[model samples]
Target: MEMALCNIKNPNELWSLESCDELEQYGITISVCTDIFSTTILWMEADNNDGDPSVFLNHFLDTVTRIGGCPQRLMVTPSRENEHIATTQTFLRRNHTDCYAGEDSVMGGVSLRSHMWIHTCTPWKICFADLRELGHFTGKDLDKNLIQFCFLHIIQDHLEEFVGRFNKNISDHNILRSQDDGPAEDKLQAVLPEDIEVCRRRCTPRGRYPCDETLFEYWELIRTENGWEVPVDRFTALKLYLHLRNVMETCIDEEEQVTCIDEEEQETCIDEEEQETCIDEEEQETCIDEEEQETCIDEEEQETCIDEEEQETCIDEEEQETCIDEEEQETCIDEEEQETCIDEEEQETCIDEEEQETCIDEEEQETCIDEEEQETCSDEEEQVTGLLQ
Candidate 1:
């Protein structure tokens, strides 16, 4: 006969004696392990098939309960087994207890599971069970989610207080408060005396209580010394810090925008001034050019006048020369006339002398005649005498 081995795959699947009998007839043996929390199954060969399976299952349940069914303890190796088992035992003890007796009993104290159960049972109980175990939590322990939750709670309870402390009137007209509101107050009001008395009567002073006074006083004390505390006063201080930070950031952005606008305006003004200066320079150049042209025209006119004066002087000199030549010709004509007159006078004088000579000749001839007559008489007388002789 060939021996066969088969394993059941799923614990959730139906198991029956009839199926086991059928597997046995085929010479097969099966074993199963089930995890209660996950509803999973593990299958393996039935090495010891002689024992009853019911007895084994019952023993496993009992053992799992005793160990609190902590998966970490079951999975750890021999080196870390002691630590894992200790942690699981502490959780089991805390789960069973309702509250711790004192600080000495805080080690292996009440777990968060018990506190959650209590919270579910009494929804109004705001117990800080974990704080009792850990003494205090701060900084990294206080994340944004917790801070926001605390902040909302503060706003719900003390909104009026916050507004009044800052001297802000949140009227219908004021939608969002302006930045002009003064600084926020550093401290917040403690819980009322009647509320504290009620809390005191309801629970022990050192024990966990649900009222606002206990939490507020506790946080204030912690903050006074450490400067870091949990959101006990509804996170009033944290809200103020956040508000101031936002205001400072807004102011900085506005200043930067104004500076940029001023710079652009200055640049535009400078450009306009430069354009005006260039236009003025062009106008000056045009005026200088016009003046130079007018000077050239004046010089040209003066030159033309001088040329005309010189031409007139040349004409006057020519006229004067013509007059002098005419005067010399007139003088030469006068001298010729004088010389002809002198010649005529000399001719007339010569004629008179010739006439005088002719008259004298006539007179002398007459005298000679007379003298001849006398001589003839005398000669006749002499002739007569000579004739007498």
Candidate 2:
């Protein structure tokens, strides 16, 4: 007897058979067989008492092919089992023909579609034509199921590589949640006002130049766009604070160097003034010594004149009045010399007082400069403290 089972024209229709026994009662033992690609299942008779099994199997496959199934989807079966209890165990067994034939084939593309339906709750739509254009699928006129399967496999491979290589613990849901939270810039601005103010003040007036507002702005852009939150973690916040503090310290150091240079210049000026004063004292001393020498020469000349008058008196023996007159002139010149010496001594004492006064003034100037520098240092320290806070 020859029989035809239901004249099924499509694999979809043939897959509706629930059990092999349904066909077995009619002397048709049906088996569920996967295509070479394992993309879909097809029905074939494993045993036919009155006909060749291969002829029926080939006819069934030809019908599938004519109905638009690709040969890659309906080629030699890897394994076969009765439809009712067929499992993955039967599919992987080495005894089956074509079990190792397509070993190097991309199975991910073939199995991805059905695997998604079984393992995932979400339905994803993919375009095979687009994938083909992108060079992901090289097969000409591929099926939708195969495309979906291939795209799913591509996603799986990418995710595996990303997780393994990048060590990212984030998921799609987390990304979606972050986006829903709104722009990060607004969040950053809301938390950074106080810190910005502090940094600005530290950079202004006290610093050599104004603080770079652009640094803060650039940081804000990066932080917001990269998904970093405001009021950042403790470690990152500390790092930022330290950076600002370092900038402030650099400004402080420059200012200090300037102040020190000014102080050094002032000290140098003071030393120059003292040197000029010493030179003046030396000049005055030389002038005084010259005046003393002139006075001594005058006294010696007066004494010689007195002695000449006495000798003339002795020689004349009657000129006593003239001799007394010369002696009185000599005494008057000596008194004038004594008065001039007293005046020079008084002038030297006055010069000494002036020099002491100049010394006091220099000391006071140095003290003032010291106080000013201390105040400047204190102000800079306070500014740094405020910035850190």
Q: If scored against the real structure, what TM-score would every candidate get?
A: 0.23, 0.20
Query: Candidate 2, residues 1-389: lDDT per residue as tens digits?
Result: 01221332222221221113222222223333333211133433323222333334343334333444322212222223212121211221213343322221112212222332222212222232343465543542222222222222333333344334322333343355457754222100011234323323322121121113454454446556756444323234334333433444576699999999999999999999999999999999999999999999999999999999988877776556667777777877877788888888888888888898888889998888888899988888899988999
Tens-place lDDT per residue, model 1, 1-389, is 01100221221121111011112221122222322222222211221122333323333333334433322112111221123233332343333332321121112211212232233223111222232234322223222222222343433234234324323332322223223443322211122334323323322121122224444454445455655544445335454334433443476589889988998898889889888988998899889888988988888898889888888887887787777777777777777777777777777778778888888898899889999999999999999999999
lDDT winner: 2
Which runs of model 2 end up more than 4 angstroms from their true locations? 1-237, 303-389
Top candidate on TM-score is 1
Q: Give candidate 1's whole-model lDDT.
A: 0.39
Clashes of each: 0, 0
Angstrom error at residue 387, model 1: 5.7
Candidate 1 stretches with Cα past 4 Å from truth are 1-296, 354-389
Count clashing pairs, candidate 2: 0
Cα error, residue 169 of model 1, in Å, equals: 75
